[model samples]
Target: MGQVIYKERKNTNSTKWDDCLEKFGKEDLLPLWVADMDFEAPACVKEALQKYLDQGVFGYYKHSDGYEQAFMNWEASHHQYQVEKDWIRFAPGVVPAINWLLHILTNEGDPVLIMPPVYYPFKDALVNNHRTIVECPLIRRDTGYVMDYEGFEKSIVEQGVKLFVLCSPHNPVGRVWKEEELRKVMDICKKHQVYVISDEIHQDLEMSGYHHIPTATVGDYDEILVTLTAATKTFNLAACQNSIVIIPDAKLRERYDEYLTRIRISGGNSFGYIAVQSAYEEGAEWLKELLGIIEGNYRYLRETLEKELPKVWISNLEGTYLMWIDLGAYVRPEDMEKVVRDDCGLAVDYGAWFGSGENETFIRVNLATRRENIELAAERLIKAIK
Candidate 1:
C-alpha cells in the first residue's frame, strides 16, 4: 500500500488522472487517455528538484553548460545521435515549438503537412497558427504503419507544402520510423526544399528492442531538419515545461533564435532546465525499470483482450506507452465518445477526431500507470465490451 502511495497524484492537479472529469465532462470515469504516466519519478529526480525548490529563490535562469552537456551526452549515449551543444534550442514544450515554427517559417496560408491519426494537436497547432494542414496519413500494412512514400511524394508537390511536421515513433498508432523510412522522407524533403520539423518528444520511451532513429542523422541535409524533444514526457516533468528544439544548422537556428528572443518567450521555464539536467545525469536506471513496467502493462492488456474480449483490435505498439484500440466493431455513428464514457467508464481519445474516417473507430489508452489500476480499467472495459 505504501509503495502505491509513493506515486500519489491526487491533489497534484495531475492532468492525466486528477482533473479528467473537468476535461471529458464526466466525474466518475477512469482516466487513461493522456500520455503521462502515473508512477513516481525516480528518487534521484525528486531529490534534485527538491534541492532547487528548497533554495526558495525562484528567478529567471538560463541554460548552464552542464545543461547543454546533458543534452549532448543523452543523445549520443542513448540514441546514437551526436549533437553539439550549440544545436539545442530551448522551448516551453514541443507543441509550442511546433506553433512557433509555423509562425516563423510559413506565411499566412502556407501549408504545413502532418501524418494523421497522430497526436491530434498537430492539426490544431497548424490551424491555430493560421497554416493549412496537408495530411499524408500513414499506410497501414502487415508490417505496421508505413510512410506511404508514393502518396507522400505526390502530396509534397501537390500541396506545395513548405514544412513537414513529422512524428518519429509516431503517437496513437505506434510505429517507430526506421532509418530507411527516415532516409526516404529526408531525401524527399530535401528534393523539394521542404523544411522538416520532427517532434521526437517520445524518443526516450521506446520499448526494449526498438531504437529511435534521429532525423538529423539520416542525411547530410543539415540545415533542413529541426528536431524537437524534451525530458517532459520521459520524466513526467511537463509542469517544468522544458523542451529543446535541436537545430543543427546554425543559420536556421539563428532565424528561430532571433524570433524567440524578440518575443521574450524562448528562455523556457527555470524548473524545466533544472529537472532535465538532473533526469539525464542520474535517472537512466530508473527509466529502464519504468520501461519494464510499461511493457508488462501492455502485455497484460493484450492478453486480457485476447482471452476475455477477442473481438477488439489493438495496434501493434512499438514505442511509447500509448495504446491504440480499434473499436470499429462496436462504434455507432452518433455515440462514439459516449459509449466509452457511459458503458465502460474508460476515458480515451476518440479516433474520429484524429483525422481518421468514421469507420476507423478507435481509442487510445495510456499504460504508464500502476499494475492494479491497469487491471481495474481492463476489467471494467471487458465488462463494457461484452
Candidate 2:
C-alpha cells in the first residue's frame, strides 16, 4: 500500500511545475514549493464540473440555496464548526477577501499586525492596501511554536494598530492554534478594540489530536473577528476559485455586502457553487484518507532526513501537508536556498519566500504528493546538499 503512485505532471502545464520552467528558465527541478496538492481533486468535484460542462451553458451566476447547503453540510460533518447558511458569503479567493477586509476596516498608514514567518500573502495583502504591517513574530520553544502575546499586545497598543491577521494552523510553521492560545489573542484584541482577521484555510488539514477552533468560536460579543476559509486547500479546489467570509454578526456582514457590491464581487461563478457543494458533501471520506497519507509522508520524510541528513532538522508537523525544514545547521541559509534550487533541482519554497529574515535558514516543502515523489525529491535534495 505504500507503493506511491507516480502520475506524470509533465506537459500538463501545472503552475507549480511547468510555470517554473517557463518563468524561471528551469523545468527539470522537482517542485515541492506551492501549497496545492499534486493529487487529483476528489471524484465528485470532477463529476460536478462535468455535469455543468455537459449542460454547456456558461453565464453570470448568483449563489443560491444549494450553494449554502453545501457549506452547511460540510462544516457540520467534517469540522463540527456548525456555521449557519446566511453567515457565509462568497469571494473569488481568500487573498482577495483579505485585501477587501483591510480596505473596509482600516485607513491609510494604520498599522496592521501579523505573526510572521506566517503566510506571505498576509504581508502582501497589507502592503497592497497601503497599510503598515507590524510583525509580532512567534517564539518557538523547544517543543513548539507559541504566540508572542506580550509583543503582540505591545504592538497593538504602541502602533494603535486597528487590525491583526491571525493564521491558524499557521502556514510554514504548521502549529495549530490551541484553544487557550486563541482565547489569549482574542482577549487581547478585545481589550484593545482591535479587529482580527483569521485566515483558517488550513483548518481542514489538521493532523491527529489537533482541532481547529474558529476564532469566532469563543464568544459572540465581538463584531471585530471575521474568519476566512475556502474549499480550495482541503478539497484541492483552488482552481474553482471561491471562498467563504464567515461573519457571525449581521452588521459586519452588512459592511461586507456594501464593500462587495460596489465592485460587483457579491457572489460566485456557477461551477464555484457546484465544486464547493460537491466537495463539502461528497469529499469527506476522500479527505480522511488523504490526511492519513499526508501524515505518513510527514513521518517518512522526517525520519529519512533526520537519519541521513542529521544536521537538517524537520520540525514535527502538527497540521497541514507542509514541512518546514531547518536547513541552517547544514549550510548558510542563502546557500541552502540556492543548493535546493540549483544542485538538487528541487525548487522548494525558500525561507525568503515567506518573508525576509522571518524564516531565515528555514524552507517550506509541500509534501502533498505521492510518497515516492517525496522520497525521490528528498534523495535528490540530500545528494545536492551533500
Candidate 3:
C-alpha cells in the first residue's frame, strides 16, 4: 500500500465541484455525487504524463503495442482473464462505446435488456440509439440484490430482445457478481441467443473480501459476450478519455472495427494512450490503497447512520466507491431533494435517476474522497434526519 493524499478541486472546472450549481441547483453543498475521485492520479501516471510533456512533440499518434499489451497483462494477472491483442478496440469512454455497440449489435427499435436500478447511462445509450429498453429489475433482498434469472429470461423472450447490457460489480447497488451468478445469466442469454455487453468498468474496485468475475471467464459464451472496461476508473483518469473494448469473437470484432472505420474514428488522443499504459503498468499498489480507503469510509458511514437512523436501508458495499442508502424511513420520497440537498446540504446522485420510481428516497454517495468528507456527510444526515 502507498500513502493516499487528498487534494482540493473546487475551482478546477471539475464537474463534481464546479458544476454543482448546474446539476444539483445548489452551490454551497458538499459535493459527493459524481463518480470521479478527489485524490490525485497515481504518482506513476503523473510522472509518465510529465515525461510526455517534457518531450513537447505534439504530433499525430500511432498505434502502440505497449498500450494494448499492458492492458492485456493487467487483465490476465488481476482477473485471470487472458485477452488476445487482436480482440482489442479503443474508445474514448465507456458510454460512447456502449452507444456504438448498440448501433452495431441491433437494428432500429430492437429491444435491449438491462438490470435496474443500474448505471443510468445504459438506458441512455439504448434510447439515444433508437433501441427499445427492456429492464428486468434486480430482486432486492434484505441482504443485497440478486439477479431475477427467471424474470430476465422472460423479458428477453417476450420482448424479442436482441442485446443485453450487463453492469458487472453493479453501480448504485454494489454486489460484485459471483461466478455462479454470472454463469446463470450467461446461460440464460445463450438460451435466448442474445448478444451480451458486459460493462466491467468497475471490475477493479472490489472491497476487502470481494472478487470480480469477468463474465466471459465463467463460461464458453465468448461468441455472445463483448467486454468493456478501463484503467480510468481505477486510476481516476476519466479526463484522459481512454477505455478498452474486448471482443473475443472475431466476427463481432470485425463488425465493431468496421463501424469505427466507417465513422472515421481512429483512436483516442496521445495523452490518453500514454496515461492508460502507465496506469495499467504501475498502478496496482495505488489501487490497493484506494480500495482500503473506500472500505474504511463505507464502514464509517454505515456504522454512524445505522446507529443513529435505525431504519435507514444502507446497502452492503461489495465493490465500487459508491454507497447506496435508502432514506425512505427518515424522509419521504417527495421530500428527498429538500431533505438531502436543501436541508442536509450535500450533493448526491438521486435514486430516481438510477431506476424506476421505487428508489426515489435513496441516494448514492461517492466514497473516494477524504475521510473528513464522509464524516461530514454522515454528520449532516444524522442531524437532518433525526
Q: Which candidate number has the best TM-score?
A: 3
For model 2, residues 246-318, the per-residue Cα lDDT tens digits are: 9888888898999988998657778888898888878888888888889988888888888888888666688
Q: Where does the lowest 10-residue lDDT sum fall in candidate 3? A: 1-10
Q: How far is 351's C-alpha from truth in model 3 (Å)?
A: 0.2
**44, model 3: CA deviation in Å?**
0.3
Error of 3 at 63 (Å): 4.1
Task: List residue ranges in candidate 2 displaced over 4 A.
Answer: 1-6, 22-24
- C-alpha TM-score for every candidate: 0.95, 0.95, 0.99
Q: Over the full model, what C-alpha lDDT does candidate 3 score relative to the true structure?
A: 0.92
Model 3 agreement with the true structure over 131-214: per-residue lDDT tens digits: 998999998899789999999989988999999999998998999999999999999999889999999999999998899999
State which candidate has the highest lDDT.
Answer: 3
TM-score of 3: 0.99
Model 1 Cα lDDT, one tens digit per residue, 1-386 = 23211376766788876776787888667778888878776677778879988999887666688988987899999989999877878888899899888877789899888988888889998888788889988876653678889988899999899999999879978788899999998999999999988999999888877989888888787868889999888887778888888888889988998898888875866677878899899878888888888899999998897788777778787898898887666666467666788887877777776776742577888888888878988887777667
